[model samples]
Target: MTTHYLLNKLRQENPLVHSITNQVVSNDVANSLLAIGASPMMAMAPEEMEEVTKFAKAVVLNIGTLTTEILEAMLIVGKAANKKGVPVILDPVGVGATQFRQEAVSMLLKEVTIQLITGNAGEMAYLAGIDWSSKGVDAGEGKASGREIAERVARRYQTVAAVSGKEDFVSDGRMTIGILNGDPMLTRVTGTGCMLSGICGAYLAVGGKPVLESTVEACTAYGVAAEIAVENKEVNGPGSFRASLIDALYNLSEQTIRDKENIKRYHVNKSEEGTNE
Candidate 1:
């Protein structure tokens, strides 16, 4: 797949992405969408979710700062998007950390037919019923394999699963890709994952590519931008890196994506062994 083609298509369409995200990262999420050339709207009221989702190209639901009221709105908007056949992305941030979080995420999975779910390895592992470690919103030390977890979760939910870490993984159970092009500094800043989820929503909003392809494109573009941001001498620290990252995103071109994307596709035989042969 051509990374530049999807990026170009997204810029041309500028589809509206509706995000019902956490308060801590709402501003960053909205800005990230705009920087990526997507129109972003943050609307979560139960009264307006269906109306907003009826016209929005994609919808992103995050459970970072979960609340009962917000949960209700998410259900409303998720179902609304499903009814319209609008692609829905779920970021189950900090799942398995609390009982309510676990229950909420499980409920959403059962209630909505999510097109994709993006999360750290820990979150994905939990969704797959694997034993992996997690702390706060970060994926902690764990024994479970990110790849296996992603594929398992994708199979279980029948949705595209994306597990992001030093190396990002995307799978739909049958096929998976390992995307290697991100800066470690991304973890230094809060809400970068949330922002990435927003980017996924933007790329998916264009609605021309499969869920896995759109996801890979979004993560690749973000990783490329982060690489550029950290390499910039003017970027002194995380704060500067954040601004520079956004600038890099704004300046990201189709040529750059075509030239710099680092992607690896993984497929398994009947024995379930791959990426090694």
Candidate 2:
């Protein structure tokens, strides 16, 4: 299915997305999901996690503010989602910052059959086991390009992976796509990546196409919305831009996505490298 069609399906279906995410971005994540016509259920209580996962069409797990209790809850939700065949999107935020975060991510990957993984370059690089300089939640510097990191992560985990940066890259082991439509202002805001992960859940829940295609569409749609948000003259800074971004997501049109989308496809070599064409 086309990206536009998938987006329409999401609005029409209004799937339930159970997001067990960090406290820092829970509100924004829910708002972003709502803006995209998805029902967001930010249920973190361990008692309700399995029940919520059963009802959810998708589950998003974010390790932004990792804690032992949160990790346990994520595992419960993720396992339940897997059993129910609900798509699960994982965002390993600031994973390289601490051994605890790394261990948490490792445990999640081992226990859950993740449908898609979304994060910045550093996070993806850490998952891909590449050498990258990480500073907290930031992407930091990496020798491997975002496309390479995304592809490696996908192959390593046997799942689709999306790396967000100046340009966003999505891969499902074999093919990788790049989206260049976002603005620098996105970095200035908190929870933008977290919100994008929630949006990814929405798209995956719609599920008309392959997981890779859905993920690529999600990243493209988000970047396009960012571009639209930044174009508003009233958006003078991150604060205004954040508000405008929600508005953009709420008003995002298929026509706008088609017009503004800057996507490029790359073929992945079996040698675990991506060649842009």
- Total residue pair clashes for candidate 1: 0
- Residue 180 displacement (Å), model 2: 0.8
Question: For residues 138-244, what per-residue lDDT tens digits would candidate 1 score against the true structure?
Answer: 88878877788888888888889999998999998778989898999999999999999999999999877889888999989999999988999999999999999
Error of 1 at 92 (Å): 0.2
- Model 1 weakest 10-residue run by lDDT: 268-277
Q: Which tens-of-lDDT digit does each residue in 49-160 have in candidate 2? A: 8888767999999988778888889999999888888999999999999999998999999999999999999999999989999899998997899988988898888889
C-alpha lDDT score of every prediction, in listed order = 0.89, 0.90
Model 2 quality (TM-score): 0.96
Q: Where in model 2 is the C-alpha error above 4 Å? A: 273-277
The candidate 2 region of ten consecutive residues with least summed lDDT is 268-277
